[model samples]
Target chain A: MARDTAREPVKTGPDYLEVRLGIYRGMVRVRYFEKRAYDLFLQNLVKGTSHLAIGQEAIAAGVAAALRPDDYVFATYRGHAHAMLRGAPMVAVMAELLGRENGLMGGKGGSMHLTYTEGNFMGSYAIVGAHLPIANGAAWSALYRGTDQVAVAFFGDGATNIGAFHEALNLAATWKLPVVFVCENNLYMEYTPIRKVTAVERPAADRASAYGLPPVLVDGNDADMVFETATRAVGLARGGGGPSLIEAVTYRHGGHSRADPGKYRPDAEVAEWLAKDPIPRYKERLLDEGVAAEVLERIEAEAAAEVDQATEQAKAAAPAHPGGLEREVFSDGGATWRR
Target chain B: MTYREAVAAGLAQEMARDPSVVLIGEDVGAAGGVFKATAGLLEKFGARRVKDTPISEQAIIGAAMGAAMTGLRPVAELMFADFVSVCHDLVANQVAKARYMTNGQVSLPLVVRFGNGGGLRFGAQHSQSVESWLMAVPGLKVVVPSTPADVVGLLAAAVRDDDPVMFLEEKALYPTSGEVPEGEHVDELGTARVRRPGKDCSVIALGTMADRALAAAEQLQAEGIDCEVIDLRSLVPLDMTTVAASVAKTGRVFTVEENPRLCGWGAEVASIICEECFYDLDAPVRRITTPHVPLPAADSLEDAAIPSAERVAAAIREGLG
Candidate 1:
């Protein structure tokens, strides 16, 4: 019950509010960065497709909190949060979205292919459910190497129906691979509502039982809830509990990408979810539980400055040298080279 | 040693030498592989080293990538070259792109061994020389050895390399015998070897066609029309220097392959020779290859579809003319 309490816990005393502020700061960082990224896209500062993780900051902040620095994280196109949470330099990610050379993937991958090997973030894929099998492959390596590392694969509700989703889950279950298949079910797959696609009432979590794997549903809007649930799941995985699927019921506040303004969703539906905005809900919970007003403001001011600095640095980052395109296509040991 | 035994020897010696090297494929373990090239590997290295996997080519390749990325060397067999389409994304995209996409931070020390090309009555699905398709994809090192020694040597080299190598063993060459080294050996990927030396003309051949070229060389020697034969040990990093040098000396060229002529590996070879050795040529470059059509299912029709030693000799004669 204490672990599930709304009040933020501290190691030393009630004044040790820095820990709680850090979580809020991370969520705010992601939130503001995504919001600015969308604005930049409108003005053509960012190029190509951009999957804004606007309302899903809590999911990333919470899930990342449950992971060790060396644990693996694989994500889909809606992956800005996952990249940020996995310890990728915010400037590099932001610059990458802007097609800068200093970006994580050297401006080659644009937004969908962010990679941070040092952070153990394998990579993000644009193809629906394409990285699921790749995540399983990484998990299998972890198991093979006898490391206690666990791999977390993040995908959207639409990916649940892909062949790779079922095959990868089955293989992971069979091998008892230490993996967490996190389905960030935002209730809509692009424009099609999940309810229309499947007769199941609950979520993708309900189908996990079919694979003989445990599944859980949580309030993806609440950072604390997402963190606590993810902690349990990750702990179970590290303890050799085998594979499990966690369905986080969040909502994407922005369009699927910059191209679409989500015209299909009814105005009432947007109003309903916006009323329960994740950041405000968590902020309210923090304040109600007696988080000092000054501490909260300082957190916001610091996060805003950090996001602004990242954006400026991203804008200033140079484009990758033209010659870099010809390099890294193959090993130099006389392999095939496509001219 | 037989071609099959030479390949088996390469796997045996490599697995015996490196504890981290493993052979994972559809029937590579207890079944000694579908072509029996892995015969006795399971008994020698045990199941851990010689692993048999499910029919999932994706899993086979993905597992190989996993193992290769994590310091283990994996030799994955696709059973037959025709099924490479099933794992095309894995081989062409994942394995090939791993090194580059990771910015050379990682090397896929993975070898894909499969019996390629249709000369036998293996039918359409089972018989195909898809080497050109793979050759079209960058970041993949393709080695199609023509003899027992080359098979053993190139495979050993592929296993030791840090790049992803496609070791294409022709289905028809499994029983073809030639002298292989008694011990371990490694061969370079891009270097071509002249199996037979002459001066009348140069015949560039690959895979099974190399053997046919060598046989044609012997036949041409008897008729006083000496022909030089260059075996292209690898397709991707093709030994263009040897080809050019030989073509420059002879002033004539003939490219041979089992794949269809249109956009075939032969076309690539011919283009390279023409670009590099056109001044040295006394006649236009000629190609002795299968017509641009899917291989026929019947044995006689299939034989007609692929280039033979006689066809290659005739092409050389025409180049000389």
Candidate 2:
């Protein structure tokens, strides 16, 4: 079957105005949400560890915008932005960090494991490359059941070194499972730089040929580029072209977590990445694209207000229920299941 | 029917009953499993449900988790229990905790079946029993069935269970045949049965150890020391009701295990016996298990390393003395 070209999201296409604006709005919301979450974490309101995808918003916003609502998404620990851009309610996202009952995962998962099953988002995994094979399996389930709903796994550059990454890609391609492996190359594996740990000159895209899959690269800072690459990959998998790897060359502007200040990163490198910050970069592009300054400013104001309201609602929400905590040990959700 | 056939029968029954039930492993489909336990399943169910996966334990288990989360009852087969070391993260961290961490929004209806134990002399690497490793994991239910009938019924129940279940099938007992009951016989998870009842002493056993204990009890009957042999089919949801009742009746208890002595699951049973049935016991809970040592290759050395009927009888005689 011929791949559906019209399904791809284009920046300069006839629908550019609405498409670009949606991407721009999502990036802004993610930026604001991460900042608000960090500020709340400072006040000790958000418990546990939180990994903010602050500067890497374009990848999440762009990749999420490329897929259908029924398509499955599995992301890593740095998944707040990924969850939000996939249409997860900001209040629920914030509630999860606050350990409230109204959180995305009933607060049992806290910040790291936020899931929106209704949206087909499988949520974030703390273990680096753990979700890769799982994502392949979800795609296998879709294929086994004869559905075209492709699955996507979002991970960082560090995860590419893990054994699971090799195993998942190998199995996914070998079985022709309908899945996309998206590597958000944020340049650092926690405090250590990727270059210091990675063996090759670049990430292992050259090795993808072993799995009978294509290796594609895109500018992570450019939302339109990410969208285009992801759209093409998702389409290929849906059309039975097997799996694909999309290397989104990106950077994270903050510390590894809430505690580290990232002193290991040189000032020139930090300044270099900060200048490529997707939100401001895209906002400038929107203004240059002839969208009125007031219109862009209004979108920015709305994002801030929505995040502020979500923060307040999250703070006021009740704590997660303690009753029947024992029953959570084993699943009671399904005694007998069928497709 | 044989224990191996029972495993295949249970899997076939479940797959025929539910369209979502699938089997994934190395050589499980075309090869009909390494032990031929899944013999003819591929031809019956087709390759889609009875999948022959690459030799990747992580992918096999991880894919099962994903399939289960998205509404498939996946039965993943590991070639051996020792390879669980390779699939540990997916089982211990991912599949086991998903439902609880998600607060019941997700369910993992998955069963992991693997061949375990050291009696057949496959040597140290392939012959180790690792049920204690899985028993410590909270979200997992560990099961070990001795008889062919019990293996058939236990597997059906495990396939239907919502939680992740580890079904350890002893390699030596696969060819052993017994009178298996008719269809739709699903045994409850936490139930135990008294193989042979007596009043003077209670012999608690798990998996193939139950066979040895029963043999030992028969020999003890000739010696005029009455013994009650009990088969503990499930480990995680231990049948303490039957254990306590037996202990109360006999006032003497002995635990026979194939696993090593140190920190074995038998420790938990002994501790429970001490706590709940302390007044009912006339003797301290005696454990007849393999000594703390890695199993060597020679048949004689391997036999010495593991518990036998004679070894168990010795422990019983010592306890009675």
Worst lDDT 10-window in candidate 1 chain B: B98-107
Cα lDDT, model 1, residue B170: 88
Give one digit per residue, the lDDT tens place, for model 1 in A168-235: 77767776777888888888888889888976765568789878976689888888778777777777
Residue pairs that clash (backbone atoms under 3 angstroms), model 2: none
Error of 1 at B213 (Å): 1.7
Interface DockQ of each model: 0.36, 0.48
lDDT of 1 by residue, B1-321 (tens): 999998889888788888778887888889998999999999988876777776777767776775576667889899999888987777887777766555555668889998999888878888889899989888888889888888888998999888888999988999989987676787777788898888988888888998899888887888899888888888777778788889878888888888887788888888877787789988888888899888889989998888888888777766676
Q: Candidate 2 chain B: worst 10 consecutive residues by lDDT?
A: B98-107
Candidate 2 similarity to native, TM-score: 0.96
Native contact share for candidate 1 = 0.26
Superposed Cα deviation of residue A157, candidate 2 (Å): 0.8
lDDT of each: 0.81, 0.87
In model 1, the runs with Cα more than 4 Å from the true position are: A1-23, A194-206, A333-339
